[model samples]
Target: MANIKLTVEEMKYMALLQDLTGAVARDCIIDNENNRIIFIVRPGDAGKAIGRRGANINKLRRLLGKEIEVIEHADDLEAMVKNIFAPARVLGIRLAQRNGRKILYVTVDPNDKGRAIGKGGRKVNIARLVLKRYFDIDDIKIR
Candidate 1:
């Protein structure tokens, strides 16, 4: 696992989230440009993080005034990537070593390519960040 440092704002949000959902947040990403907050919860805690019928997430959205996305963390790299891109199915994931660097190639359903990339490539950027932090991936290629 990578050592992720949280900003003051992110730490505040994480504290609020833990108090509200009673779930441990493994990672938190504040995507201010997209008006969204992504939280990666501990394994088997996704449903708890979101609450019943997404009530917890909705409450967080209303309180924080930002969209809330909850993802479950996985031990495996491929599984974790798939979880991060939920609703937009990933066809496959390939890892390659080149020039002493590790690169991750993700294949998404052609129909959902746009969504996988998100507006202005935000989702893919997030993917790259998360992969780099946790898996030591140097880059990501979404296909």
Candidate 2:
């Protein structure tokens, strides 16, 4: 795993998230360009992080003035990808090496292609960022 260094602001956000949701945050990614915050919580704590009717996340969004996304961490790359793209239903994940660079091939249900890609490809970009950060994946292809 690569060493991930957090800014003091991110650390403070993590502390706030933990206090608000009681979920241990594994990682936090702030996408300033997209005006969003992605939080990877310990497995089995997604519900807690989200809170009932998304109250916790909504509160964080209001407080931080950015959109919030909470994803549960997984030990396996495939499981992690699936968790990141939850509700979209990943049909499969295969790793491939091209030009000596590793890439992730993610197959999603035909009906969920749009959701997997998300508005302006934000979700796929998030997936790519997290995958590269944790697994060193060079790229991700959604099919």
By TM-score, the best candidate is 2
After aligning candidate 2 to the native by TM-score, how far in Å is the CA of 19 from where it should be? 0.8
lDDT (CA) per prediction: 0.87, 0.92
Off by over 4 Å in 1: 32-35, 98-101
Q: Score candidate 2 by TM-score against the native.
A: 0.95
- What value of lDDT does candidate 1 attain over all alpha carbons? 0.87
Q: How big is the positional error of residue 59 in model 2, measured in Å on the Cα after superposition?
A: 0.7
Q: Write the per-residue lDDT of candidate 1 for residues 1-112, one digit (tens) a residue.
A: 7888889988888889999999898888887777888888898888898999999999999999998888889989989999878778999999999999998899999998
In candidate 1, position 109 carries an lDDT of 99
Backbone clash count for every predicted candidate, in the order shown: 0, 0
Error of 1 at 126 (Å): 2.1
Query: The CA-based lDDT of model 2 is what?
Result: 0.92
Provide TM-scores for the models.
0.79, 0.95
CA-only RMSD, every prediction: 2.5, 1.1
